[model samples]
Structure formats: structure tokens, C-alpha cells
Target: MKFLKYLLIFLAVIIVIIAILAFVAPTEVKVSRSITIDAPRETVWEYVNSLEDMHQWSPWAEKDPDMKLEYRGTEGKVGSVYSWDGDPETVGKGEQEITSIQAPSRIESELRFLTPYESKADAYVQLDETGSGSTRVTYGFESVSPRPMNVLNLFMNMDEMVGPDFEAAMSNLKKLVESGGSSGETQSEMAFR
Candidate 1:
């Protein structure tokens, strides 16, 4: 009886602590990773901006080679959406829509995860010309977790979880662009007003 009482007290304390931690935890999580690809900004932008090209450099796509993908709207332009369904907890299911674009400089997207868990993130990629032949690309995503669920971040470091994926994707992007696999000819045609 004494042990049971002590256990109840301990559990109560843990619950209180967890509640406190959740309230104090950050509501927003952002993870970003950058790399310099040995190609012009337009060249890199052409690849990154294209929804179809994501299969070539995306870490998640690399995880599930046979994942089902669907596309809608104009590719590389705002409102363009790519949806994917895959196995494993890593890929799960999600749709990402291009929300904004700034030609060879920036692209903003909305990422909506529907399976495993439902969450939405604002994703973006920034491209900067570093030199005559090099372009620095920054890819990132930011999500705001509501209330108690945000506290899950206290135990799980979102940055550590997603950063590796971003890094891997960036590395693949670098390889694809530098190897002349991405065409520079399509850049001017894709530039939107």
C-alpha cells in the first residue's frame, strides 16, 4: 500500500513537470541547412524550383524509391503542389505546395503532413550567387506546434531530427548541379513575373 501511494505521488509529480515543460517549450521549430553548389544561381534554382526534380535530390525520396507521387498546378510556380505517399515512419505522407517564388533567388512553400501526424510547415529555399560559378543555397522549414503538442519538442530535438535530412538533400543537390545534371537552359524560361 505504501509503495502504491509513493508510485502515485511520483507519477503525479512527473505529470506536473511535463505539463510545466510543455507550457515553457518553444512553439515554433525551424531547421535549416545550406550548401554551396558549384553552379550558377539560375542553374541551381531551376532544379530546386521544379517539383519533379525533387526526386533527384530529396532525402525523403531517397528513402522510398517507389513512393507514389502526384503533381498538380504549374510546376515551379506558385500553387504547384506535390503529394507523396510512402512507407516507413520517415516518409509517411505529405503534400508540399509552392506558395511563393522569386525567380532565381527564393521559393517559399507550404508543407502539409497528413499521415503519421498532421502538421503544417512553411518551407523555403534561398539562392545566392557566391561567385562566377558558385551558388549558395539555403533550404529550411518552420512549423508552429499548438499548445501541449509543442511540448513534445522538449523531449525531441526537431533540429537534430530534420537537420541531417536537410544536409543530405543539400549534398545531393550540390552533386546534381555540379555534375551538369541540371540544365541551365530552362532557367530563363521558368523565371516568373
Candidate 2:
């Protein structure tokens, strides 16, 4: 019984340490993924900047084919928003707005989700010339959780949850830009970015 008591004490100490570490972790977590596309930076930038074009490339939209999506404000400009409501629990409901924009270069947006769980985040996509014909596209999302536990949970699984979407979006962007029109990427990992 003495060994059991010691083990319990050790476990409790470890849990406390983890909770403290989670509290000390950054309140705002920024997750980003980047890839090089064999296309002009401007082409890649144009496709990403337009809220209306997101239906063709966003992974979450692909998850629910019947999701109701709406567009508001002028296309490809600041203040434009893309709102989607999905029946699939995985897809959920969300809105993305262009809070700031600089065409063919950078876009900053406010992302709000209303289903599965309600959350808000700052999203940005940046395009940069990497080589003579290659462009590096970087996508990032930053969110702040009021509770330490929420931050800890997001910290543990965010990369795994969002990385593939970033990869798929980049792949689609690359194919559309390089092909001068559309993509043949049937799945998330089928195309090169």
C-alpha cells in the first residue's frame, strides 16, 4: 500500500507540473505551414486572395460538399467575407473576413467558427518569390484562448489537425497557378506544391 500511495503522489505532482507548464505556454498560438509552388507569385496570390475562389481550394469546404456558403462585400478586396455552414460535424460553420489586404503579397483575416465549437482566430496568407519561377506560400493562423486548458488542448493537436489542410490548399493553389486554370488533385496529397 505504501508503494501505491507514493505512485499516486508522483502522478499528482506530474499533473500539476503539466498544468503549470500549460499556463506558462504562450496564450496566443500561431500555427503556420509553407510550401514552394512552381508558379508565379502573383498567380498564387490572386487565387488565395479572392474569398469567392476559396470554394475551389479550401480543405474544410471539400469536407462537406453540401455546405451552404455565402459571399459578402467586393471580391478580392479588404472587408470581403466568406461564410459557410456545414452539416458535417467536422466541417462546422465559420466565417472568414479580409481584415487587411495587399494583393499578390499578404492578407490578414479574422476567422470565426460557430459550430462544433465556437472560436476565433487571426488568419494570414503570404506569398513570396523563392526562386526564378517558384513562389513560397505561407499560411498561418493565430488564436488566443481565455483558459489555459483550451490553449493546452490546441497546442497538443493543432498541427496535426490543420497541417494537411494547409498542404492541400497549397497543392491546389500550385496546380491552378501552374496549369493556368484548374487542378486534377482528387485527394489532399495528390498534387505537388
Candidate 3:
């Protein structure tokens, strides 16, 4: 009975400590990665402004070649949405909707993850002209986890978890744009069906 009493006290102390830590943890998590491409900002924007074009260089698409994709609304403008269903262990399932656009400079979107977990994030791509024909592209996402769940942020490094994928995708984008391999095709012409 003494051992059981001590064990209960230990577990209670651990839970209390975690709850206190949760109050100190950050509620918002942000992850970003950037890359410079040997292409003009406008040229780079052409590929990123549309979901279909972005898929041509997406690392997740490469991970699940047979992933199902669906599109709604207009292609490159605000309000467009791209949804994908893929390997849960890799790409999972999500939909991203274009929220705003500043042609040749930035595109902001809302990302909603459906499988593995349900969550929402604000995602953005920003482009800056670096030189005569060079552009620096920054891809990032931010999400807020409320209250107790924010405690996970203490144990998880969002940047480390998502940064490598962003790096690989940026590298792929750079190669695709530099080599002129993306084709700048319309969604109907290059659907992933």
C-alpha cells in the first residue's frame, strides 16, 4: 500500500509539472525555408501562382506518384483550392485554398489537413527579385495550437520536422524553373488523374 501511494504521488507530480509547462509553451509554430532560383521573379511566379504548376515540382507528389488530386474554382487566382489524397504515412490528405495573391510577389493560402490529424495552417510563398534574373523564394507555414495541445510544441521542433521537406521542394522548384521543365501547362492539359 505504501508503494502504490508513492507511485500515485509521482504520477500526479508529473502531470502537474506538464500542465505548468504547457502554460509556458508557445502556442504558435512557424516553419520556413528559402531558396534562390536562377530565374526572374515573374517567371518563377508563373509556376507558383497555380496549384497545378506547383505540383510539377512538389516533393510530396514524387513520394506518392499515384496520389489523387482534385481542383476547384479558378486556377491561379484567389479562392482556388487544390486537394490531394495520398499515402497517409507520407503526404497524408489535405486541401489548400488560395487566400490572397500579389502577382509576381506573394501567394497566401489556408491549408487544412484531413487525415492523420485535423488541423489548419496559414501558408505562404513570397518571391523577391535578387538580381537581373534571379529570385529568392520563401515558403512557409504557421499554425496555432491551443492550450494543452500547445504543450506538444515544447517537445516538437516544427522547423526541424518540416524544414527538410521544404528544402527538397525548393530545390526541385529551382531545378524545374531553371531547366524550363515545368511546361507552364494548364491544369486540364496536365491533370494528375
Q: Which candidate tops TM-score?
A: 3
The local lDDT score (0 to 100) that residue 28 gets in candidate 1 is: 94
Quick one: best lDDT, which candidate?
3
In the range 70-165, model 1's lDDT, one tens digit per residue, is: 999998779999999998476999999999989889989999999988889999889999876889999999999887888888889988988999
The better candidate by lDDT, 1 or 3, is 3
Candidate 2 vs. true structure, TM-score: 0.79
Q: In model 3, how many backbone clashes occur?
A: 0
- Off-target runs (Cα >4 Å) in candidate 3 are 1-11, 185-193
Model 3 Cα shift for residue 187 (angstroms): 14
Per-residue C-alpha lDDT of model 2 across residues 134-170, encoded as one tens digit per residue: 8898988998876555547645778787878888877
lDDT of 2 at 87: 83
TM per model?
Answer: 0.85, 0.79, 0.88
The order of the candidates by TM-score, greatest first, is 3, 1, 2
lDDT of each: 0.84, 0.78, 0.87
TM-score of 3: 0.88
lDDT of 3 by residue, 41-120 (tens): 98899889877777777778878888899999999888999999999999899999999999989999999999989999
